[model samples]
Structures are given as C-alpha cells and as structure tokens.
Target: MSLSGKEGGCDCGAVRFRIEAEPVVVNCCHCRQCQRQTGTAFAVNILVKPDAITVLQGDPAPHEHPTPSGAGQTNFRCSDCGTSVWSIYHAAGDGLRFVRAGALDDPHAVTPQVHIHTTDKVDWVAIPDDMPSYEGFYPGREIPAIMGEDNAKRFARAVGRG
Candidate 1:
C-alpha cells in the first residue's frame, strides 16, 4: 500500500472505487467464462491488492461461481448497472483483487500483460505473439508464475483441441 493511484466509478457513478496501490498485472482474458460474462470476445482486468482497492461510493452486487480451476472466485458487479467491476478469488491471497479494466479513469494507460484462457478464444479474434496465453484458469497463485505456466496448456479452442 505504499503507492496511490487515480480512482473512478461505475457507468452510473453510483458505485465508485479507488486503487491505492499499484496493480500487479493487467490482463485480457479470452476465456469462455469471461466472454459470456462480458458478451464480448475478451474482457480486460487489472489485478491489485484487495486492501488497496476501496469502495468510494456504493456497494457492488456480486456474482459467485464455483470455477473448475479449484479456486472459489466471486465476481463483483455494479448492481445498479449490471456492470462487472471486480473479482476476488480466495486462493489468490486475501490481499489480492481484480478490477474491471474499463472502469479505470484511464483505461488506455493499462495494457494487457497476458492473454489468459486463450484456448477458449473466439475464432475471429487475433492474438499477438508478444503476450502470453493460457488454456485453464490461471491458479490464483502469484501472478508472475501463473502467467508463465500458460505454456503447459496452450491449445487453441478454435481448432477444437480442448
């Protein structure tokens, strides 16, 4: 919590949040779960410390799902606008949190450090080789380690490898 960053709110401005610490990783997930939730080919996320994230305005409605990754993660959304705002996975450590990238005041400032769950990526989308890709949900372990083992499960779903 040594650093402080700009803060912003949800679409309706009813729910607000601030990230007091620098983010650990910025992500663009192409997982089916994320696609379904976002209704888009990919979803952007910013992983930060749970303690560093504070709700400055209102409470967010949460949607919990028992993911196959073996970690119990719940997605927090803005109830007023049905916008996914953040996610908290118990396995990631009590201090970790994942914020929706679009909610940032300067969304463009944050870029994807990794492209996760690429196996489920939409057929029409293109992936840049410069970034990392994964098949399964990255274990909520340390971000750096999780980002690399993507090598273990690198099959592309578009080709039907599973």
Candidate 2:
C-alpha cells in the first residue's frame, strides 16, 4: 500500500501531520512497556524515515520514556489531549519515527507487517498464524527479506547502516 500523502493527527485534532513517503515497515509490538504506556494490549507502529513525516499543525510535546536498552525513547504527543503521535527510539537515533498507527485518520490504511516482543504479549491477543512474529526484536539483518530491496536499502540508509 502506498502510504505516501497519508494524513493523521492527535485525538483532539491539535496536532496534524502527513506521511510524505511509504513506510519502511509496520510493527505490532506486544512488549510489556508498550502495553503499560499505551494502556492497551499492544502498540501498532508505522516505521518510516524522519523526513517522511511532515507536521501540519500544532506542535506535539516530547516525553522521554525508559526502554529496556536504557537509552530510552521519546514520544511526541498532543499536549492538549496527551495522545501519543509518534516516537523516536534511542537505538534507532533520529533516523526513524514510529508513528502510532491508531492515530491515523484511517487506521486500516496500513496493516502490521510483523509482530514483535511476542514473549510478553497478552494471552488473549492472538496473532495470525501466518504473520511474521518474534519473541523479541526483529533481526535487523533480515529486514531486507521482509521489506524488499528498495525499502531495506532505504531503512539501512536512514539508520546509517547502508
């Protein structure tokens, strides 16, 4: 699916943004931290290059949260509604942003390409049998197989790995 030009915002419509390019990958993370932070079973994130996202309206506030790696992640959220819009993980540096999928105008416009941190997933939440799932983080070297050559290259270049 071409996510280019896709638009989304915070719950209160305070922060609006657009996706200028297709996403590198989509992930449904079931980590305990994600569950606690989102107050849900999981978090569906759209992984894209930082340049791909263009904020069109109100500025979202950045809040840092601790990560297992201890480097932490910063979540940009709507100040008015306190809705998380996107996040920058320290490990990934500033190259990428993980946009909250549920914040999109049409949440269904994209689908999870992979499931991660499944070891901590809620028992009631069932991932499709055919879906690519992992007990922890997805292997970075294998991203090309899942994202295809072009996107894998894009991702690599974005993270300074290419």
Candidate 3:
C-alpha cells in the first residue's frame, strides 16, 4: 500500500509533515537507547526515503546521539513541543529517515513488522508471536522479506544497497 499522502505532526502541532511514498520498513526497536529516548518500552520507527518526506510546517531541532554501532544519529524534534519527529542514522545513510510513527496523525497508520535489539528489551515487555524479533539489528538485506519485493527494491535503491 502506497502511503504517498500520509501526514503527521508534533504534539503541539507546531510541526507538520507529509510522506510522499510508502514506508520502506517499520521497526520496533527495543534497544536501551531507544527506550531512553522514547521513555517507553520501545521506539517505533517507520523507514522511508529521505526525499519522500516533506515538512509542511514549523521548524524542528536536531539532537545528535550515539548509536549502538558507535556511529551517531540525529533526531529531529519539534522546536516547541520536543516531540521527536524523525531520525537520520549514519548507518542508514543520507537516503533514509526513521520517522516517529507516533507523531503521525494516526499513530496506528503504520504497524511495525519487525522488532530489533531485543537483547536489551525490558523483562516485562511482550512481543507478538507472529512478528519477527531479532536479538540485535537485522541484516539490511532482509528488507525484501520484511517489506515485500517492491518496497525492498525501492529501499535498496534509496540506501545505495541496490
């Protein structure tokens, strides 16, 4: 399903955005960093092409932080509300954006297809049996199986993996 027109914003509505293409993948990251950043059990991020997303309104502040790979990532948050809107991971490269799914107008618009960094997950957290869960980050090549052939091809091309 193409999510070409999906829109979202920060909590205070100071920032708004639109997604011009279908998401490449959806991830539920249970890493400690993710938990700390989200202040929750996990962080739900929707991966999409960089140019596919458009900021319709407001300015977002960027905060850089270190990732598990020792590489850093930058989170774009609302200037007013401090809600994380998206992130750019050094590993994911310049072509990808990890959008905060909860920032979408409909938080449930996208559902996570995979769970990553489960090795650091909280003991009380429960993962659905049907969804794939990895103890650590999964191989990038596995996108095809998780997001379908079309999305995988697009994602690969976007990330220079194709």
> Which of the numbered candidates is closest to the native, going by highest TM-score?
2
- lDDT values, one for every candidate: 0.70, 0.91, 0.87
Error of 3 at 101 (Å): 0.5
Q: What TM-score does candidate 1 get on C-alpha atoms?
A: 0.77
Please give, for residues 36-142, the per-residue lDDT of candidate 1 as tens digits.
Answer: 87788988887676677888999988788776567777888888987788887655544556788787777766778778888888899887876666675554444
Between prediction 1 and prediction 2, the one with superior TM-score is 2
lDDT of 3 at 119: 95
Give candidate 2's total backbone clashes. Answer: 0
Regions of model 1 farther than 4 Å from truth: 1-4, 137-162
> Which runs in model 2 stand beyond 4 Å of their true positions?
none
RMSD of each: 8.0, 1.0, 1.4
How well does each candidate superpose onto the true structure, as a TM-score?
0.77, 0.96, 0.93
Candidate 1: worst-modelled 10 consecutive residues by lDDT: 151-160
Ranking by lDDT: 2, 3, 1
Residue-by-residue lDDT tens digits, candidate 3, 1-162: 445798999999999999998788889999998889888999999898888889999988999999868779999999888999999988767889999888888776777899999999999989999998899887766767887999888877877878
